[model samples]
Target chain A: MKLYNYFRSSASYRVRIALALKGLDYDYLPVHLVKGEQSAAAYASVSTSHLVPTLLDGDAAISQSMAIIEYLDETHPQPALLPADALGRARVRAIAQDIACEIHPLNNLRVLRYLTHDLKLSEDDKNRWYRHWVESGLEAVERQLAAQPGRFCHGDAPTLADCCLVPQIFNAQRFDCRTSHVPNVMRVFEACMALDAFSQTQPSACPDAA
Target chain B: MKLYNYFRSSASYRVRIALALKGLDYDYLPVHLVKGEQSAAAYASVSTSHLVPTLLDGDAAISQSMAIIEYLDETHPQPALLPADALGRARVRAIAQDIACEIHPLNNLRVLRYLTHDLKLSEDDKNRWYRHWVESGLEAVERQLAAQPGRFCHGDAPTLADCCLVPQIFNAQRFDCRTSHVPNVMRVFEACMALDAFSQTQPSACPDAA
Candidate 1:
């Protein structure tokens, strides 16, 4: 398996954690997002969306972190990322999408660049933009977990939601986003970070870490 | 089952299509997005994100259209929203997330409102902001579908990918985003609309549609 990734990409970080948890080995192929390498024809051939964390398992090429991670779970079917039931899977996917679809998209590198260059928002304003979405998105996540959260986002064992949450908290701290307010998230994040799987795949520790 | 929906919400529309495909009966409780009903405490209880398309099934409340749809699929199990195989499921999920996570967030109501009211982008500029993301997102979606697209996004049956693609195309056309380019998408959109499921749930046909 060949994993096309960027060290700091929370999306790529997700796939890496899933791989580690499943104990599957894959060669890391970095595609730097900041340098416009993802837009090149060679990379575009593999990743149609020109995004990082494209996984190729022989002929099965996949993009979108949640999708890739879900695919990995489906194929491997050991140490399952999703719980056995429907409601459990929904809870996990909901938590994952709350970050992937809501928080991360608004503060993505491209969106921030647009805010600064095209919309003429200042750096401080851009940071505010980042913090605003993160705070709100995580607030919703906290509410969702308020009922079901245990040691992990769902129960004691880590599920797919935890895989996504760990990386997001990593990025949130990187941007100096408002973490002090989200204690539930902070607690769970620390728990996941304590795990060897998550800690080993931390952005700074990646082979292509800048 | 009860679905908190807005007549024209693209996200809600996706869930509605999935419900219809799964042949599950649901009470379509209209929550007016434009009227700020989603933000109301009643709706927000079920939807922490304060977004439309919250599915309340018995004790299980699900948010996020993709998550909700998958839950429905898991419970129903006959007309599976996902493809049968792992690689096939990955392709479908990648197609869905390419729209849900990547494109939809950038063009969502909050972002548009922020662009216009907060930063004071001109109406034309706001339209440009809407069109810019829509065009590029659809183009990327087109590329994702170019290789394996059949009668629907995956096969002859309408999988989860088609459920997502139809609503997005509907919104793109509503906003007058570029459409003459992606012939494959238009064909699939037409194919989906021919069914009672897609046709009946359309914005114009919905009860709250005004």
Candidate 2:
């Protein structure tokens, strides 16, 4: 497997964690988003969206971190990313999407560039924009986990929800967002980091980390 | 099944189309997002994220439109929302997430309202924000579909990609985003809208359209 990855990208970080959790070995081919390498012709040919963490498994090159994680889980089902039952799977997916859909999209590099360059917002305002979405979004995730507080986002074991949460929290902390409100989320983040899978695949540990 | 839905919510609209496609009977319980009904205590009790399109089936309440749609498809499994092959499923999911995670989240009502009220941007600026994401995002989807020009997003049948795309295009048109570049997406949207499942469950046809 070959993963087109960026060290700091939340989406790329997600797939990295998933691969580590599954104990799968993959080639880490970095596409530096900050350096605009993702927009280059070679990377563009591989990923139509020109996004990082595009996993190439044999004939298939998959984009979207959640989809790639699901693909890995389906193909190699040792430590499943999703739960066994349909309802459990739905809950895990919901939590994952809660962060992936709501928080990460708005604060991505492209969006921030648009805010500063296109919308003409100040750097401080852009940082504020970043924090605003992350704080509110994670608070919602905190509520989602309030009823089912466990070692991970779903149960005792880590699932897709945890994969997404850890990366978003990593990004949240990078932006100096207020995460005190999301105690449950923080607890889960701490638990996830204790495991070698998450700790080893973090942004700082990545080959592309500056 | 009961869907805690809002008429114009793009997320809610995706589930409605999925339910209709499966010939499933679900009560449309409206949660007026514009009226701040989703944030109310009662709705929050049911939906932790306080988002519209929370699907309640028996004792389980599923949030996240993509998750709900997947749950419905998994439990029903007649007209499959995902493909049979792992690679194909990955492709379909990538396309769905292309819209769900990237395009829809940025243009969500909360984000737009934040742009106007909190960020103090003018309405025209807000619309530009909306159009910028939509146009660029749809063009990416167009490139995705260009390689595989079937009747639908994946193949001849309507998968989850079509379910997500149609609603997104509906919202894009509502905001007057440029659509001429994304002919494949528009073509798929037109093909999808012609179907009874997509046509009958649209925003205009919903009970809470006002």
Candidate 3:
């Protein structure tokens, strides 16, 4: 398997964490997002959306980080990323989407670029936009976590929710988003960061990191 | 099952289509998003994120439309929303996330509100921002559909991908985004709209639709 991804992309970070948790081995093929490498024809052939974290398994190429993670879990089910029960799976998926859909998309690199270049926003305004989404989105995650308190996002074991939460928190801290409001979310982040699966596969530790 | 959802919300419409496809009945408890109902304390207690389309089944209150649809598929598997195999499921899910994560999140109500209200962009600028993401996002979907060339998103059957696609295209048309660029996507949209599940549960057909 070859994973084509950027080191700093939260979506890419998600797939990396999932791969590590499953104890899987794959070649890390970096597609640098900042350098416009993802838009090149060669990389575009692998990813339809030209987004980071396209997992290539033999002849098959899977895009979308959440789908890739679910594919990995389905193929390698020993340490399941989702719970065994249907309702449990729903709970975990909702938590994952809380970060993936609600937070990450608004603060995407392209969206930020549009804000500054197209809309003519200042640097301060751009960073403010970034922090606003991250701060509010994490608050919702905090509420969810408080409702269902656990060592991880779901249970004692780290599931898909943890895989998503850790990366978002990493990006949030990078932008200096207000983390003090989400104590439960921060607690889960601390627990997730303690694991080798998360710590070793983070952005700075990736092969392509500056 | 009781679904607390807004009529025109793309995410809510996805779950409605999924339920209709499965031939399952759900109580339509409308949470009007435009009226600030989603932000109210009563709605917030049911949905931690205060997002639309929270499905209440017995005691479990599942948030996130994708999660709700998957939960419904799991509990009642008459007409499965996902594919039978892992790779097939991955492909279907990737198509679904193509809209759910990439396109829909960028054009969300709150995001658009921030663009005009917070950033103070003109109405035309805000509308342009809406069209930009939708047009570009649909082009990516077109490329994926062209590669697959299914009667639906996956095969002859209407999978989770189609459930997402139809609502997105509906919104695209409402906003007058460019649909002519993606013939393949429009073709699938036409095919999906022919089905009762897609047509009957559409935004206009909903009880709360204005």
Candidate 4:
């Protein structure tokens, strides 16, 4: 198996943690998002969407972090990334999407560039734009953590939500979003970060780390 | 089962189509998103993240349209929303997330409101922002459809990918995006819409449709 990834990509970071957690071995192939490698012809063949973290398993290829991670979890049943029940899975996905769907999409590099260049917003305004969405999205997630958080984002063992949460928290911290307000997110993130899976997959440690 | 839905919510609409495809009988309880009813205390009880399309199955309340729809498919196994093989499932999920994770999040009502009220982007600029991202995202999706698409976004039948595609296409149209560049998306969307499940569950036909 090989993972087409880029350090600093929260999406790629997500699949890395899942691969590490599953105790699976795979080649880490870097595709730099900043260099426009993702949109180039080489990467497009590997990923039709031209996105990072496209996992190649034998003859099969997969993209999208959540889907790839879920693919790993489903294929490797033990050390499951999801809880045993349906509702539990729902809670996990809801929290993940609170960040993936609601937050990260707006703050990603492409959108930021669009704001700065196309919309003619300054850096200060762009960062402010980044922080506002992060703050609001995290607030909703923090409410969920306050209500249902355990050792990780869902229950005691690290689940699919943690795979998503750790990356978003990494991003939240990188953006300097106010984590002091969300103690539960901070706490769960600390727990997740303590794990070898999360620790080994940090952006700075990746082969593609800039 | 009961669904907390808003007529125009793409997320809610995704779940509605999934329920219909599964032949599942679900009571729809409209939560008016435009009216801020989604954030009201009563709706908050069922939704931890204060989002719409919270599926209440008996006593189990599930959030996240993808998760809820997946749960529905899991429990009712016939006419599966995902393919049987891991690779097949991954392809289905990536296609779904290409829209759900990357595109729709950026163009959702809340984000549009943020672009307008918070960023002070003129309505024209906001719509431009909407169309730009929507068109670019679908262009990538068109590349995806070229390789794996059949009668629907995946193989001949409507899968989870189609559920995501149809709503996103609806949203792009709502913004008056350039559909000529996304013929594959338009094709899949029209194919999905032709189905009774998709047609009946459409935003215009919903109980809360304006």
RMSD of candidates 1 onward, in order: 1.2, 0.8, 0.7, 1.2
What TM value does chain A in model 2 reach? 0.98
Better of 1 and 2 by lDDT: 2
- Candidate 1 chain A weakest lDDT stretch, 10 residues: A140-149
TM-score of chain B of 3: 0.98
Candidate 1, residue A106: Cα displacement in angstroms equals: 0.9
| lDDT tens digits, residue span B75-157, model 1 | 89878889888888988999999889988988888888877776778888888878888888888888877787799988889
Model 4's alpha-carbon lDDT is 0.88
CAPRI-style grade of the A/B interface in model 3: high
| Candidate 4 structure quality by residue, lDDT tens digits, A36-125 | 999898888889888888999997778899989888988998789888876787788778888888888988989999999999998888
TM-score of chain A of each: 0.98, 0.98, 0.99, 0.98
Candidate 3 positional error at B209, Å: 1.7
Candidate 1 per-residue lDDT, tens place, A94-157, comes to 9999889988988878878877887678888788778888888899888887766699888888
The best candidate by DockQ is 2
For residue B10, what is the lDDT in candidate 4? 95
Q: Distance (Å) between predicted and true CA of B140, model 4?
A: 1.5
Task: Tell me the tens digit of each residue's lDDT in model 2 across A78-119.
Answer: 898899999999999999999999999999999999999988
lDDT of 1 at A48: 84
For each candidate in turn, the TM-score is 0.97, 0.99, 0.99, 0.97
Global CA lDDT of candidate 3, please?
A: 0.93
Show where candidate 1 strays beyond 4 Å: none
